[model samples]
Target: MKTLLRTLLIPALALITLGAIYFLSAFLGMIIPVGPEKEEYPKEVEIFVHTNGLHADFVLPTTHEVHDWKDVLEGKHFGEFETPYLSIGWGEKNFYLNTPTMADLTAPTLVKALFLPSTSAMHVDYMYGKPREGDHASSIWISEQMYLELVDYILGTFELEDGKAILIDHDGYYDYDQFYRAKGKYHAFWTCNNWTNRGLKKIGLRNSLWTPMDWGVFYYLEK
Candidate 1:
């Protein structure tokens, strides 16, 4: 009995210690800024960064002067709806489809997601209008050039074949929301929030050096 108990305690303690170190590293990475974002450009286009306390999502107007997302994604998948904005979020495929609520997340599934690099998917949600400034949401004004850069980056993330993104047909929470196959692997270092962070960085937005949580992306924007 003593031997078995000792064996269990060692690994349990190790896991706890590792978890603490990871969280500490993430906290530090989030606080450190890459550099000041380009403020010289006129803030003409409005883009939004949204979080649900756990995940970060990018919200943009469905049609911009330079690009139209409806041209890329099949409008029919989102059903017939008159929406001015669309929300996009990328994350692990299994986790995204299986774990709608945190309560549904299982230990084995989480371990696989964090340790093993796996398939990724993008969630596209049609929005009726722009979100107001409030908890879990914030807006950023950027130039047309920067917005185009961001748009290109987003389009590249899609797994295109025959010049179109493949949709993952599945039963989900809303008729207005759907998932599509994406071009990246999901892992601990490259989290969903990191995808949003990298997109901001690519568009010359002030962002964290590295972040694993949604709050990191919001830290600079909130301030």
Candidate 2:
């Protein structure tokens, strides 16, 4: 019995230590400003970052000066309702398809996400109404150039086939939404929230140094 206890103790302590270090580093990364200083834009464009407890999405206008989102997303996927904003999110394909809600989440899905190189998908949600003030959303005002750069960064995430997004044939939880095959592989380190953080960094926006969770991404945005 003593031998068995000793065998279990070391691995248990090691896991606890690793967990502590990961959370500590994530907290530090959330607070630290690692990118370029926030700059003022003459011509402001309203973009938003929204969080639903665990996941994060980057919301952009449907029609910008440089890019017509409809040109890529199309009206067919969005249904009859005309939406003003498009909310985009990325995640592991198996987890996304299998676990639409918290109730559907399984241990196997989570274990696969953490241990394996999983296929990725992008969730596109069309919003008719704007994000209200004091919502679970952070609004950022950026220049036209910055907006263009941000759009380009988002477009690059899509795995294009013949200059078009490869739409995944799956019904999303919401009405005005769909999923598409994304470029990157989803893993323990490179999560959905991390993707949002990288997108903000790409456009030279104020963002966390390294965020693997939704709250971590929202912390600096709220500040």
Candidate 3:
């Protein structure tokens, strides 16, 4: 018994020692500044709808950085809920988060809050090609109601001339012609895929509990 115990103790101690070294190294790595960290972009919690005819101006939230979406969601106290939508704002990025209409709207005209410049948007690196399986840029997980409403608005408001609607891409970088064509080519990527559109279809709602992946980006439609 003594011999066996002695033999086991040596390897156990080595493992413990190695674990300590690894923990220390990992802890140090977090603190040691590597490259210039990306500063958290400002976000707005509330939106104000000016009386003017112009669209509402979204407020800016505090300029704070976080390690991941988990941190952002945890702080909000709605930890039990999962976000339904995922979107990224390019430089001056624009994409519909929820459907907008003259009815079921609070503002006199139309107010939609666009949560933009999210950290998720910043994390993406892109090129003009079909997004891969794990392409974060391609997948947007939106709740069913918001998805349908957006689709309705898209189908109703915009006339899809030449088999395409005007989509906001990479900050509307291309002219109207290019933007329309891009949407025609990449409609499924933005609208359908994964458990997103399917999940939305399963649970039919007019305005599903669709929240942004970075829930921080939105613009008020009527406000």
What's the lDDT for residue 128 in model 3?
27
Report the C-alpha lDDT of model 1 over 93-173, residue by residue, as the tens digit.
998898888989999889878999999999888889898878889999989999999988988899877767788887665
- TM-scores for all candidates? 0.95, 0.92, 0.21
| Predicted structure 3: lDDT | 0.26
Candidate 3, 1-223: lDDT as tens digits: 9999999999999978976764465344323332222323233222111111112111111121211223221122123333322122211112322212234344411211222222111111112222332212222233334344434432332334444333324332212111221222112112212112223223231111221221111111111
lDDT against true structure, model 1:
0.88
Task: Pick the winner on lDDT between candidates 1 and 3.
Answer: 1
Better of 2 and 3 by lDDT: 2
RMSD, one per candidate, in order:
1.4, 1.7, 22.8
Rank ordering of all candidates by lDDT, starting from the highest: 1, 2, 3
Q: Give the candidates in order of TM-score, highest first.
A: 1, 2, 3
lDDT scores in order: 0.88, 0.84, 0.26
Off by over 4 Å in 1: 77-79
